[model samples]
Target: MGIATVNPATGETLKIFEPLSAEEIEVKLALGEATFKQYRKISLEQRSQWLKAAADILERDQRKFGEIMTLEMGKPIKSAIAEVNKCALVCRYYADHAADFLKDVPVTTDGSRSFIRYQPMGIILAVMPWNYPFWQVFRFAAPALMAGNVGILKHASNVPQSALAIEAILTEAGFPAGAFQTLLIGASQVESIMKDDRVKAATLTGSEPAGASLAATAGKQIKKTVLELGGSDPFIVLESADIEAAATTAVTARLLNNGQSCIAAKRFILVESVADRFEQLLVEKFQALKVGDPMLEDTDIGPLATPSMLLEISQQVQETVTKGGKILTGGQVISDRPGNFYPPTILTDIPVDSPGYSDEFFGPVALLFRVKDIDEAIELANSTIFGLGASGWTNDPAQQERLIEEIEAGCVFINGMVKSDPRLPFGGIKRSGYGRELSIQGMQEFLNVKTVWIK
Candidate 1:
């Protein structure tokens, strides 16, 4: 299949490219392996300088890069620019911190003097998604390259231009030709690429099925894999929470990235006392949101990345409605205009077996649940198979402690929205996928933790 960029807003094909042939793939693989040998010997200071330069480029041409992302993936223009800026921040973060993060750790072992040395493994394969394209890749590449490992990106086919732009950014920043390359190939080609001996490990940020396939393939080779997959994160509001604040945040929390984000709050569990007021506030806020072209600065929500995404979320909402759920706001696709525009939606009185209660709704849709107390809220929040990220709003110190301790997620935000930060470790648990990304833990994911002993 040809790799192409089809505008989600207009359903028009803007650009297309041929997938790499077997011969081309072989050459890139060989080049990556060869580059790793020499790149690994380069000093930390040099790598840091190159990474800093990459950050500079990102900041200098952020609007250009931001437009590429908005056109390819349909994220709002303002958010797209923010994503590029975040990518630059991560580059600078790793550039300044990788040396300390990877420094030898002196250990008190039996050998006269023992220490743990962190070293690059080799060429790493990154299977990334179209959503947050720049942010995701840079978060992986900055540390991977800083630790001396090279990267070969097999980005989502629909975002080919975005993918190529990333390689150009790194190359312009002075990274070696093979130090970071973008593979313009289809998903069918990933298996063969991963099987190659030159590719040492892999990292993926996408769906659960994709993550499972990569992990299984790498498991056979005994090569490592890190996955950041789907999430149906919970947003809990108890009786003590400031209802006004929680509802305002709930709008943005549920609809960020047009609701394509894995960590965007999908399920909202509220105590019965505040449920009515919170639901009213949510409906007003959702209705106030503007749905239009992603390229517009004032647009609050945009099209789903693809038509299939629109169909899937529509079906999910219909299923919930069929199973006794009530639609408090939007429930239909905006068909008068072109593109995959979906209005912000809310579903309440959801049945136990409905998609609203169990499945992840990857669009501008929110599922609301009411519970009698915090006990029921916590129990309902942990019901899903995904334990990625969760947000809890409460002022009572007792409830705050309980929420922090009881939520079955990798990270829980009290009185705030769930988000990923460069300074903190980010990932999920259970079906949300294994391993971590961002911070010190992320940089170490593909490194070899070798033990050194001195006589």
Candidate 2:
């Protein structure tokens, strides 16, 4: 089957491209391997220059590319523009920092001049999601290329133009032909590509099932894999938290990427004393949001990336209501809309067995849970299998310390929302998927940290 770009806003198939044939796949694999052999030999300065050039190209035409992202995936135009700008920031960040990050580390050993050198392997396969189309690919490509490895991207099929746009940027920025490439094949084709000996490792950012399938396949081959999967991140608000600030941030955190992001706050666990006020503030904010076309500059919430996402989220909300939950604000699909549009929704008093209690809401739906105290809040927050990220709001030092120590998430924010930054290592624990992304740690994930000893 061929890949196509279907606009999430109108449910229209805008473009289609045939999947790569066996011969084409072989050509790319050979090119990836051959390119890595030559790329790894290139100077850090040269790679850095190209990365910067890519960043420059992105900055110059971010709006145009941002529109493409909005058209394909239904991200609000403003947020899409911000996403494209952020990609450029990541490119520049890796360009400036990769050398220092990969420099040799001196180690004490029996050998006089003992050190550890970081070297690139070969081709890396990145199976990325379409939520933040440009951001996700650039984050991987910038570091992978800067570290002297080639990347072959199997981006989510929904955003085929985005997949190709990335390759074009790298090409126009003066990178070698095969340094970075996008494969237009479907998910079924990913395993065969990964099984190839030329592809050294794989990194995925998608559903748990997809990550598991890819990881298992890679495991059988003993090829390393980095998986960033689902997250049911908790936004915990304690009695001492500034309820206003916490609730305000919660709106953005929960509805980020039209509530399609893996890291978006899904479960809001609130202490009893502050729950009512926080709930009131959250509802007010949700009601104030403008839900409309992704291309609209003023729209705060846009359509879900696909119609299936709309159906799934609607069913998730219905299940919770049936299992003893109350819809405080919005919880219905927009029937008149042509696109996959679901209004901002809030579900309160969700029972323990309700789907809202455990399942991740992949749209603009928020699950609110009331807890007796910080202890109950922490317990409820840690109950999920996903330990990706958590945001705790509290002014009490002891409570803050407890939140930081007790939250099962890989990353915790005391007062701010959980977000990915180039300076910080980002990833999750447990079922949220393994390994890390961003920072020096992310750059080192696919590198060979070889120990060098001198007599």
Candidate 3:
């Protein structure tokens, strides 16, 4: 797709943006490198003040930003507003803690004095996604800017307005124009950007193919890169779990962002003893969801982010059914809708070879599997090629401990849903992608750790 905002709710093209030409991209890149030289000399206190002001602006105009997000990406207005607020929280978080995170660490050594200094790497490129446009970019920009590194955002093509809005917010909050910039560019232009020596390390959050392509290209340059890719996260409920609570949270976990989240639970594993009950609850809840315009206050579900997304999800569900997976609730697309709307769906009795068994269903669809015990639960949970996150429910201490230690995912929530927090390290292993974002680890991803010693 080209750089433009096409409303996913009504299939309306609200705005169009031209891709930045090669010359324009060069200007921004030169500015980023030049700004980094001066920006890194600015006091941490000054950077902190600017970032804190960003938080203030985000809070002041959250509703306006939220509408931009919803109009571009089809997330509900309430959730979109909440996402903007989260952007503010992350700005404040890094603004308050970045100085401590980047402080020189005194090392005990044979030399008279030794320490490690954290320093900025110039022009960090952020390849963000459309799912959580504002949150994803801020999580990267807040720390990068606070650490005195400039940023260049190559956001998803479909959310051009959201991308520009982010650049505007940062600039309005007293950041120099070069400190952060949005490039209205397509996927084809990314390789050229990475090839530029001025652009240092890079970070991306998107599909496996996109992440792999970027990583491969960056690897050739011997440059550092962080990737947060696809996930088929499992949600397990054992015999001892609170069926009611697990069932309730399961719906939200599966349908968040219209079921477009990478960490949203995709596979539901239930102990045979509770499988029937949990399955019934899930079906009832799925059938009860309200699917309509995302801008409506009472709508529970909205359109998929794009028509291609809608088509891919429908094909996956159909293939699963053809492979012997039984649908307990929704099994077809809502043809009456003018936009990309798919109802909440539940697939059970899945064969091992079905898409429901292994593929990450990136829509409002849930795959249910029945296991005999905790051993089966863990085994089934770890069966997927993706291992981004897992949410397990159990009251037994031993079972909980086993789930925590045995589950092969980056994150395991014992009794709740899997969600990203600004204070915690977030990322995954295996096919889900590598490296980390958020927390102290994320702040240091693109920094140079220099060691100094004195005899």
Candidate 4:
């Protein structure tokens, strides 16, 4: 099947695109290789200038770009706008910091002048997801481009328009022709791209299966790969937490991006002393969210990005309930809605052995588990196979310190919500995938760390 954009809110096909033929794929790959040969020779100052221009274009056309994202992926209008702005921020960040980050470092090598130099690899294949269409691609593109690596994007099939728009943005920003290209192809086409000799390394921000497939392919080719895969992040609330604040933040954390984010809090582990009150507040908070048309400014939650997502989430919730879980609030899919809308669901007493305990619910559903103490909280939080991000709510300094030290995640937010920032390195440990993104570390991911030794 070719790429198609169906408005998730209305279940209408807004646009469709035919996949490129084998000839077209070869032509683009040749162009990308040709572009990288010249593009990598450009000065850092020149690349920075283009990146800054891209940021300017994003800020200037945020409204238009945001609408495209919303129309294609069913994100709320406000969130889509914010996503565009965030992409701009990342562009600006890499533009400003890339030179410093890639600077050569002198090393003490046996009384001679030796240094390590960071240089770009060849064309990189970026297999990106559609949950945060614009943000995800830009996060990869900004850093890779700044590192002097050309990119070939294989964006999720559902967001073809966003994928094309990104290529346009790069061209408008004065990037050399073929510096960045979008491949409108399906998952089946990725292996061929990976096998291309010009494609040096690959990075993926998607599901576990996708990550595994790409890693396996790249592994056989001996090409380096970075995988940012799925997460079932935990939100732990201690007895010392500011209950009101924790309760409010928990709702937003679990439901951001309509709960499609891999780092979005999926499991809630509340200390038993405060479990009763916290659960009460959580129910109240989730029940008050306004779910409707994503185009509306006031909408707090929107439909799942696709019908499959809705069905999967619904099945997970139903399975959890059947396995002795309790639904405290909304559970059924919304009625009289043309879109893939499921009610904000809260499940308590989910058995630790149930599938919901390990699965990342890629929608607005939160599982609650009452813990006896801080030790139990941490145990429950770390029980998942994914370790992308975690949040702990507590007022005690010692408790906060302990949780931060022990939480097995790429990021830990104490008494606050977890989020990815352009300034901070964002990536997960364990099954959540490896390598950092968006900071000085992110800029170095696609670079060649050449070590020079003087005789």
Candidate 5:
């Protein structure tokens, strides 16, 4: 199948491109390796300058780039614009702080002057997802490039245009010719690229299967890999939570990115004392959401990125209902729509053993559960095999501290929504995948942490 832009809103194909042949792929690999030789020798200051320039380009052309993102994957035009701005923020952040983050740290060992040095690890293969197309790639690109490591981006096939656009941005920003290049290849082609001797390490932000495949391949080759995969994050609202605020934020968090984000609140765990009120408020908020064309200014939710996503989400809903779950609203697909649009769905009384309980609802669906107390809330939240992120809403200081200490996720939010930021580490625990992204931990993910000893 050729890589094509199929507008998820109307299911129309706008453009297509054939995958690169073996010879072409080899040539690009060679270029990436060659680029790294000279690129890694550059100073952090020089790399930062180029990175900031890329950020400038992103800001200058945010509208155009944002439109491309919306057209390709069906995110709201407004959110797409925000995604672009966020990408720029990450770029500028790394550009300004990379020198400090990657600085050599002196160690007083053996009474001699020795220090640990941070270095780049040749060419990094980035296998990224399409959910937040630009943000995902830039988060990796900003830090990897700033560390003097060349990157070969094998972005999700559906977002080919975004991939090429990013490559263009880096080049125009004064990066060396092959410092960052988009490989217009298929998933079947990724392993061979990873096996290449010149490709030092890899990073992936995608599904569990994709992460497993890449991690296994990188392992067999004895190369390092960082995987940020799926999440079925819990959004816990205790009795002491600001019920109105928690309910409002819950709707926005669940419906974010049309519910395609890995970090979007998937499970709602409400304490029993206030569960009735919380559920009532949540239903009102969900019903009031405006789902329509993503390009429209007032649209609150957009279609799933692809038809397959719609089908998967619908199936999850059906399975949950069959297993004795109660649908409070939006149990069916929207009628008379050309795109993959599913109404925002809310299911309550879903059995803990139901399929939906363990599955990651990939679209705009929220699973509600009521627990007797904070301890039970924590129990239900930690039941999932995936632990990418979690959010807890409560005014009790002791409860908030306990939740933070007990929640099984890479990142935890107390009385607030969970979001990825350039200033904090983001990733997951358990089967959600290993390694962190964003912040100081993110920048260090693909770096060479070398320790020096003098005797």
Candidate 6:
């Protein structure tokens, strides 16, 4: 097998796969371009119908699909199922709103009749990551396909089964043979795929380096690219916030996806007045979490997706400790387990110049920061290169308003956790990457907004 699946939960090489050869890749390129020609012509009503059918398939066998994700990437079985359901939600959302979102917008021009038509730009290459594997792909696929643009997915090598499963769903939903396809390829093969003249645009959700590589290659060709990269989102808790609620939610925010999530709240910024209480509550929550087999129904945190990820996280924690950061709760690996497991750890006394201060700790480790006031809290929140999302906890109306306006992130949640919603535009600024991925704006990313004038 050129492309294969490995069980992350047990550290077992369950299967191996061979990547697609150049010749096979060429056939897929031809197939996608040719299929898109007819697929784009299909009416929006028909496309919506097919997308809904795909959603139905996902919802009906969500547990089955969830198991594949869990087996591949080590997400807890419950969260894996939720990811499947969320994929269906995005598909249904795009299916229901694509028509309205893409309808012609009349232009005020010299011509008697002029409007902007959002027409599909043909084949798109999607390089999706393994975290929330199903959700990430579907969010892009739902909008891209609903807008009449065909997609070819080059999903993470570890989740090839999930990738193929997605293609199967689209086919079972009656999409044409090549309307949506999964290419079993590697990173070295992506640039060549994007080089195809028939491939109109490309989108990626992964690390900063990967995004830069794809964006650079696609830029040379002048093809459009949307990159959603890594994030070290700030979870700010002001003195006025509900300390109990904020602390409780902080645990979930940091440990989400076993802290593998790009949008996970790595920095916990608490105002000095409430720092001690928040830290105490948060530590309690973290320690109480059940860390074990992802297949277990009640496990709060699962193993990191891979051994390297586990080691990287452990090193980050130790570096923080070496640089004067104090561990308030758990630290180090849980060696008793077979899979890649790490204890939920919290750190404090980390100065601004500390190595951990600006790094995105992509694990179940939290770096705590104590702020003097609203001004300092806002400054600490925007300190990192990542501006993907932020959660500002405050009860004061004026403070909420300030946080909402001053936070340098694409999406901000006041008194709540930061997350992606199918209805809202999702993306980031600075090093976090650009381009929206959901809602009305997402559907237009790969479309030709042509101006039609009838004088």
Candidate 6 lDDT? 0.90
* Candidate 6 C-alpha lDDT tens digits along 177-209: 999999999899999888889998999999999
Each prediction's total of clashing residue pairs, residues at least 3 apart in sequence or on different chains, is 0, 0, 0, 0, 0, 8
Off by over 4 Å in 4: none
Give the RMSD in angstroms, all C-alphas superposed, for model 5.
1.0
Model 4, residue 363: C-alpha shift (Å): 0.4
Q: Please report the TM-score between candidate 4 and the true structure.
A: 0.98
Q: What's the TM-score of every candidate structure?
A: 0.99, 0.99, 0.99, 0.98, 0.98, 0.98
Cα lDDT of model 2 by residue, 1-455, tens digit: 26888888899999999999889999999988888888999999999999999989998998899999999999999999899889999999999999899999999988979999999989999999999899989888989999999999999989999999999999999999999999999999999998888899999999999999999999999999998999999999988889988988999999989999888989999888888899999999999999998898899999999888999999989998998999999988998979999999999989889899999889899999998988888888999889999999999999999999999988999899999999999899999998988999999999999989999
Candidate 5 residue-wise lDDT, 306-344, digit = tens? 889888888889988998999999989886879999988
Provide C-alpha RMSD values for all models, in order: 0.8, 0.8, 0.8, 1.0, 1.0, 1.1
lDDT of each: 0.94, 0.92, 0.93, 0.91, 0.91, 0.90
Kindly list the per-residue Cα lDDT of model 3 for residues 1-455, writing each as its tens digit: 47889999999998888899999999999898888899999999999999999999999999999989889989989899999999999999999999899999999999999999999989999999999999999999999999999999999999998899999999999998899999999999999999899989999999999999999999999899999999999999998999999999999999999999999999999999999999989889988889998998788889999999999999999998998888888878888968899999999889988788888899999999998999998999999899899999999999999999999999999889999998999999999998999999999898999999999
Q: Which parts of model 3 are misplaced by more than 4 Å?
A: none
Looking at model 2, report the run of 10 residues with the lowest lDDT sum: 1-10
**How far out, in Å, is residue 4 in model 6?**
3.1
> Clashing residue pairs, candidate 5?
none
Model 1: lDDT equals 0.94
Least well predicted 10-residue stretch by lDDT in candidate 5: 107-116
Candidate 3: minimum summed lDDT over ten consecutive residues — where?
328-337
